[model samples]
Target: MKSFSILLAATAASVLPVSAAVAAPAKNIVLVHGAYADGSGWRGVYDILVKDGYHVSIVSQPLTSLTDDIAATQRVLDKQTGPVVLVGHSYGGQIITDAGADPKVKALVYVAALQPDVGESVIGLAKTMELPNGDVEESADGFLSLASDKFVADFAADVPKDLAEFMKASQMPVAAIAFSEKTKVASWRSKPSYGIVATKDLALNANLERWMYKRAGAKITEIDASHVVFISQPRAVADVIEEAARAVK
Candidate 1:
């Protein structure tokens, strides 16, 4: 962790201590990534959370359909030893919305992610926002991906150019139809949620990020970063996730 963000987290922790009733925060954390990205992107945030004595797990959700992604997350959830703090980024939000209803899930954290209601979909929710041009590229075989050239600019401008370029080349392919798949459940309705809004995000509207978080009634945090704020601002992101975890301990 960077010195500044460590201090930033400490300051935030001081201002908001854990409640007396929470004997211990949920020890298990499950991280879910969005489209065009994979579980590896969560390494930085994972390290911070682990260092804080939290047992963390990552779900490699295949970007096929909402049901497939939810199934993938459930596999991980089923193995947890205790209640889980379910975290999602971008498109992964809907996955948690569905899987988070699992009895093992205790909390949710959204990192500039989509939060839809029962029967809502990524495409339906996207229609409410002004999406970036060239941010999405559809392959002939039907998989959707991020445009390599625009990735750094739209997805990870806060990240270094070299790392951003590498991420572009290694991008995960999401099924284009995933966006149209509606969620059958919205866990945010039944569970407490924490949200992070990337102020400089271009791929998803910053205003829409605010709107969705507000709609979910989440405790919100804002950062001046692109969509991949988790990579560029891992410490701060981890802090917020930790905050949500601590509340449900």
Candidate 2:
């Protein structure tokens, strides 16, 4: 009976650790891409998170209207069962600012993203910066395209040549009207926010990136890359996101 009791105590000790491990929380990561890009932009980051055992989802924004894009992101946020680390790039930051209001969203990560303030439109923000002339071409049909020549020189110079080319070719035409639409709510105001500033970004000037971070009161991480920080500095961007994920629990 003494030996059996000792074995039973050993079993309980072993089971306690396993039970605690199983009870620990799981992290969920949601990626939102900015204008002129699709959800595929998150391929590298998504793979990294998945390998680390994170539940991940990438939202495909229509790039049509602010309300529509926010609604699309909100739909994805709604499906998450636990705390979520919402990551947004460029224009996507704007989407998260509004869609990230849900109680489930534990943190927000902005990658060289726009952190617009209350009642601010893209036009209002861009007006303060000296964006290259003719960088964005507007069609008679009211769509906007990122000039191919500036794709690498302006937005993605630090990325590999092939990947930059691929990004250029895959650019989606965003409705011109979307830029005029202002954000009604800003989630960064309430949520724990993190910002990745791309120092060499030409599309959104480096100074603007700093401005956004300061305005949003986000914990800032700086990277010496172009506007597409995730493509040029994937690991660094992922690290910031992982930190945000860790903060949830």
Candidate 3:
């Protein structure tokens, strides 16, 4: 009987590794930032992911045009040696919705982002819903940016004032036409998706986030933060990203 027990223990030990392998998280994670912000904003989330053993890459795509942004994301995806969990925030959602179609991408996470379907433009969707704060402005040359005075209140109300001010000072002005360009693909339809809704978001209506995420059939998490949920709630955002990664085969 003792020998039989010892044999059972050995069998359990042998199965442990297979179980672990099956549950292992996806190794590669690519984070995409939206217009008016750069990849630097992903620092909080990136640090958390790296500490948790993820190989994370943040795409700093020039917000020049939809094609350019998508190309930039695809370039990053090409560098990964294995499957990737592609994540996007704000306008970056439109980017991932198109770029996530890459064969190497295993899943997608949208954080307070615009998930536009094929033939749909960000401008088109924004028209369907009214933002709580209309603090954004367009330049004479046709670039779009948030008004400096309203940046903290509109975009990063939950983050520290200093950081929000810096984000405002360093905001990337996306071409106005970028918002008018339509997406050619919607990857969430094919890939497993997770969504985070910032219930206190003012820049983009929180209700719009719920509608888009639900339409895409994304697993959703709602947090009481501003538009920059990834910055204000990095730990929670990382948790959802890791959840998406684990769901990947």
Per model, how many backbone clashes are there?
2, 0, 0
After superposition, candidate 1 runs with Cα above 4 Å error: 1-22
How large an RMSD does model 1 have? 10.3
Error in Å for residue 61 of model 3: 0.4
Off-target runs (Cα >4 Å) in candidate 2 are 1-26, 132-134
Global lDDT scores for all candidate models: 0.90, 0.86, 0.93
Taking the tens digit of each residue's C-alpha lDDT, what string does model 2 give over 9-113?
999999998886545554889999988889987888888888888899999989988888998998998899878899899888888888888888878999998
Top candidate (TM-score): 3
Number of the top lDDT candidate = 3
Tens-digit lDDT track of model 3 for 1-249: 999999999999999988886667688999999989999999999999999999999998999998999999999999998789999999999999999999989899999999888999998999899878888899999999999889999899999989988999999999988899999989998888998999999999999999999999999999999999999999999999999988887
**Against the hidden reference, what TM-scores do the models get?**
0.90, 0.88, 0.91
Q: What are the C-alpha RMSDs, in order, of all predicted structures?
A: 10.3, 4.0, 3.9
Which scores higher on lDDT, 1 or 2?
1
Residue 54 CA error for candidate 1 (Å)?
0.3
Preferred candidate (TM-score higher): 1 or 2: 1
Give a tens-digit lDDT track for model 1, residues 139-170. Answer: 99899987777888988898988989989999
Q: Pairs clashing in candidate 2? A: none
